[model samples]
Target: MKKISIQGIKGSFHEDAARKYFGEDVEIVECRTFRKVCELLDRDEVDGAVMAIENSIAGSLLANYALLQDFHLHVVGEIYLHIQMNLMVYPGVKFEDIQEIHSHPIALRQCSEYIDQHFGEIELQEKSDTAGAAQELAREKYKDVAAIGNQRSAEIYGLEVLERGVETNKKNYTRFFVLSKHNNPIAGTNKASISFQCGHYYGALAKVLTIFGDNKINLTKIQSIPIVGKPNEYSFHVDLEYDTEDNYERAIHLVLKNVSSLAIMGEYKKGDIELNKP
Candidate 1:
């Protein structure tokens, strides 16, 4: 079985995306932090890792992007997971008895609206991971404490789900990058993630954006990360989708002429857009 590391415990969204992108059969190596996932993959402790790159509501995780480049890991694939944050507790524990709730900071932010409205007086605590919070609650047998996690956490930890789909946005989804030591491209790979460094010259980035448009390549997303130890210099990471390999190649050819460095992060099939059901 393949051991793929993830930023959170088995019941976390990272695990879900890992299983979705790789398969349910793959061995899940849980890591407490996203950086640990990248480190493990780089050191060959695991075959790959599912790293959350961005969320629809909270936006991009800039630190994770830096970790990818710093660790020199490649994006072998991508996964989109529909986020559903639920409040869970010990079995038979009444919701009224819950006075404190804890979860990852992102999870808390995602469900801020629900927390304020329903759990107004609840003491919110931030933990290292969402599922870890539930696992801790179960292990410590804290009946007064609750957790915001996935249903899998409740099932695995033998807890009861008090509330479901508590996230502020029903359309909330997180984009995860399947990182590996190698750039393994698959058939029907219509999407590519590339990072480039542009000169301070005028229109440097604009010129490349034009190249993408002229070549019929869709620039789905772009992020600018600061280059370490280099002031005022930034590296641009972009995701491009093309109808044909020829167009992708042509765009890269033109883009290379305008940038100091161009690295093709990966060429993989685009993930399907998933939304939580009402």
Candidate 2:
């Protein structure tokens, strides 16, 4: 069985995306941090890793972007997971009995509206992972505490879900990158992610973007990341989609000539937007 590293235990959304891409039988190696997930992959301790790149509700994970650039990992594929945050508790714990809620900070932010409306003035503790919090709650059997997690976590940890779809937005979605140490190109790739640095001269960035437009390449996303130790200097990371590989190659060749430095991070098929019913 293929082993993949993830940022949380079996029931976390990372696992769900890994299984969705690698199948249910794939072995999961849980890590407490996203850096560890990349480390395990870099060291060849696992075949790949499922790492979250961005979320529709919570915005991009900036730290994770640095990890991607630092580790020099390649994105083999991608997955979109519909986030359905739930309120879970120990069996027989009533809603009124709950005084504290615990979960990952991102998960907490996603459900901020729901939490404030129902549990005003309650304590909110940030845990490393959502499933870990739920697991701890079940292991300790905390009667006065509730956890915000997913339904799969409730089932795996033997906790009762007190409420479903507690996320402030019903359409919450997270985008994950299936990363590998080496570049393994796949056929029928309509999307590509690349990073490049532009000169300080006028219109240097605009010139590079025009190359893609002239070549019929579509830019889906673009982000500016500050260069480490270089005050006021930045690098651009962009996702491009092209109908033909030839057009993509042409645009890339032209972009390479224009940018100060360029790296092709990944070329993979785009993922569909997925939703999990509550």
Candidate 3:
């Protein structure tokens, strides 16, 4: 069985993504944080790592992107998981009786509306992970404290689901990337992910983007992240999907000639889907 490394414990969304992509039969190695997930991959402790890349509601995971650059791991696959945030409590505990809630900061923010409307006075505590919060509450048998996590977490921690789908948006989903030391040979030859730093010159970004327009290559996502150790200096990460023919190569070459520093992070298969059906 292939061993997969994921950030957070068994009940985390990262683990769910791993199981969804690699199947339950695969062995799982849990890491405490996103950086450790990449470290496990770098140290060859596991075959690959699953890292959350973006959320439909919360926007891009900037920290994971930094890990991608620091680790030099290739993006071998992608998975989109529909998130179902739930409020969990100990058995026999009533929602009206709860006075405190705990969960990951992101989960709390996502369900701010529900909390404000129904439990405005509830004291919110931020934990490392949502599932971890549930596990903590379960261990302590806290009847007055609830946890905002997934239903799976409630089951794993032997907690009751006080409320399901507590997120403000019904279409909540998170995009995770499967990273491996080896790149998938069968991945999309047409797709490319690149990072570049532009010289501090007027119209530098415009010139770089115009090359893609002129060559008719589509730019899917563009994000700017700060370059560590350099105050106010940022690098642009871009995802480009285009045919890997001579035309695409020519376009890339044109952009490289003008950019200060350009590095192809990885080019792998692109799988887009709306998850959680049935």
Best by lDDT: 2
1-278 per-residue lDDT for model 3 (tens digits): 89898888878888788888888888889887788888888998899888898888889988788888888888877788998889899999997879999999999999999999999867999999988999999999997999999877888889999788888987888988888887656533666778899887788988998999888778988988777898756699888878655666898889888887888777666656576862
Per-residue lDDT of 28-140 in model 1, one digit per residue for the tens?
A: 99887778888899889998888989988888988888898888888878888898889999888898898999899989988899999987867899998888999999999
Sliding window of 10 residues with minimal summed lDDT for model 3: 183-192
Between candidates 1 and 2, the TM-score winner: 2
Better of 2 and 3 by lDDT: 2
> What global local distance difference test value does model 2 have?
0.91
- Global lDDT of each model? 0.87, 0.91, 0.85
Clashing pairs in 1: none
Q: Estimated TM-score per prediction?
A: 0.94, 0.95, 0.89
Per-residue error (Å), model 1, residue 15: 0.9
True-structure lDDT of candidate 1: 0.87
TM-score of 3: 0.89
Candidate 3: stretches off by over 4 Å: 228-233, 243-247, 273-278
lDDT of 2 by residue, 42-120 (tens): 9999999999999986678889878988999998888999989899999999999999999999889889999999988
Better of 2 and 3 by TM-score: 2
